[model samples]
Target: MPISNSSFAFLIISAFLFLSVFQTHGKVIINTNGIGQHSFADMKIDCGKECTRRCQLSSRQNLCRRACGTCCARCNCVPPGTSGNADVCPCYANMTTHGGRKKCP
Candidate 1:
């Protein structure tokens, strides 16, 4: 049986639409724990704001601190007297110094 031109066009359009929807339905598996996933260290180097926000929302507070510290150290914001202080000291110093202080700048 000869296929009609309209039927052929319909088949092609249906196939294209199906493929487009299939692509849109793909699963995006994100590792919410941030372990064995995309490196925060790398992302922070390039995109500091996004990295900081993600770290702030992290379930593991220590991990978040570490991530923030890594970004700060890369950006040369890590303070003095910080001995492996990636977990607390830097952030504490920043908060205490600048939380509500009026800057002369």
Candidate 2:
């Protein structure tokens, strides 16, 4: 069967509306400072609060917050919970310190 141009156009518009509503589709967005921008186009995550939660139980809270915040800003993800489970965010997991230690808590 042959489809009309109007039908195709309607389908495209419908798909666009669906995506805009659900935000299943995203666009590249360069940030203000242009550093620590997320690769994904979704709204920015709260790295400060996330780092605070992640570093709450740390012996060195300041150090943990700094590192976790850096990783969260760059990777746009911090592993859930205060300790362990680094596997969830690969970029957060693979980051290393100058001393060859794990960077993110």
TM per candidate comes to 0.26, 0.64
Candidate 1, 63-86: lDDT as tens digits: 655655555553434323323343
Candidate 2 stretches greater than 4 Å from native: 1-39
lDDT of each: 0.45, 0.81
Error (Å) of candidate 1 at residue 4 is: 0.4
Candidate 2 weakest ten by summed lDDT:
30-39
Candidate 2 structure quality by residue, lDDT tens digits, 4-76: 9999999999998988876664765544553533456766789999999888888999998988888888888
Q: How does candidate 2 fare on TM-score?
A: 0.64
Candidate RMSDs in Å, in order, are 15.0, 5.6
Q: By lDDT, who's the top model here? A: 2
Clashes of each: 0, 0
